[model samples]
Target: MIKITYKMKSYRENLKDIIQPDDTIIELGCHVGKSSQFMLNRIPNGNLIALDNSPEAKSKMDKLSFEYKNLSFLNSDVRLHESLKKVKEKIDKCDILSVDLGGGYHPDTTFKVYYIWSSTFKPRDSIIRNRGLIDFINTATSNEDMHSENGFLDSCGDMGIPPQIKEFKLWSEKI
Candidate 1:
């Protein structure tokens, strides 16, 4: 799986460059079928398994499945064991794993999904679009900087910190 350590502007922003014509893809959090269609167009012979928990997303995907024979939709949540088990029964393996849950807002959830799915499929490559994770990597500093007199708030950059969070120590201490 490919690990991206920098900030990406959009979800799976660089996927077009990596996807091959015959690469099987499993896309988690396919909101509608925009990205799914793009991937289908790329892989004429390959297959795509698009998974989403939303009823709205499922309705759209159900329609798309009719139009594309190679496309399949699974209404399942990546975070749930039962849901994932159902999804696993449908697909054995894939060449690429693409994930963009919650529009890539929650890094923790994104990491969890990536961990579970990567372990299940063991894809040749993976692309995860999470702003929080990218920002965390971009803003990380050295241990010496973290131990500065000003502390974590002053030492680390502020790219990923949400406005709702007032204090880093308080948030970190919670969990």
Candidate 2:
């Protein structure tokens, strides 16, 4: 077993709490498979669909694929609607969904992809990076802020998903 740092150790433990042995998981922005490896360790009989736009990340994931039979890597831009749609088609549903697109910018593209893809499966549990979560909640809740925030939220509103937000502390430590 790999020894994770304290922060990651707690995050992994939180994930393990929500993830079942046979639950399917879809992770967006799976850079070099750090989280993927942790998730793979938990789901022995389940499946993991990891997506990333970086060729280097894909290369690393490709190597890890040989070691993990339950993992599948999709080398594509998660911000693209077409790419997300394609993934949604492949795995109709999953028990857990994790999003960590990094950069802390492009909330529009990030939430757009997340909203669209999440609508397909509607996983019971979703873990999003703090910035993404804040952006999503802010846009979803207040209409006035929606106009000023970004066009993606307006677009999401047009799709008709109600603004029902719930907050929770899933992990004790920040990653």
Candidate 3:
């Protein structure tokens, strides 16, 4: 259900802002290991926990881990707290937690990056975001998805104003 679009550049920079040698990463939907691979290469001293419900995730990560020394893969569904418990034991307060799998694309493909991140990371330490439309296009295609950029900015605009997307225009002027 998870679709992978590797927006390697933005993703890498985003990770760089927060990822440190001491930090660990937990990607909710590893989907063919695109983000996993990107983030893996970035943090050589740190470790990445890649999780996915798809059968391919295990095999792909197994192959990928061979190249990256600090990577591990787990076959787990982020939706199920029970499934997440063991992974939680290994990685909580992950430096980066991305919800890139869920959407109309995948029904149960980690629809709650916010909730999981809220529970997993300290409020001050957490830097979590969802990879819905913008992230997906940016990740899947080899080019920058301008639509996603606008969408993300538009979303932030909504966050700024009447607290509704309809009021997004109001925030644009404030910015």
Winning model by lDDT = 1
TM-scores of the models, in the order given: 0.73, 0.68, 0.58
lDDT of 3 by residue, 1-175 (tens): 1222335565455556655665577776677887787777677787887778888788888898898878877787655555556665675456556555633343222334434333444322333333455455466755544432211222223332232323112212222
Best by TM-score: 1
lDDT of 1 by residue, 33-110 (tens): 888988899899899988898878988899999999999888877666665566667776778888877555559778
* Model 3 ranges with Cα > 4 A deviation: 1-9, 102-113, 123-175
In model 1, what is the error at residue 109, expressed in angstroms?
0.7
Residue pairs in steric clash, candidate 2?
A: none
Write model 2 residue lDDT over 37-134, tens digit each, in one string: 98998899999999998867978999889999999899988655456566667776777777777636456655555565565556667665535446
Model 2 residue 172 distance off true place after TM-score fit, in angstroms: 39
- The order of the candidates by lDDT, greatest first, is 1, 2, 3
On lDDT, the stronger of 1 and 2 is: 1
The runs of at least 3 residues in candidate 2 whose Cα sits more than 4 Å from the true structure, single-residue gaps closed, are 1-13, 103-106, 135-175
lDDT of model 1, residue 56: 82
Residue pairs with clashing backbones, model 1: none
User: Residue 144 in model 3: shift from native, Å?
Assistant: 33
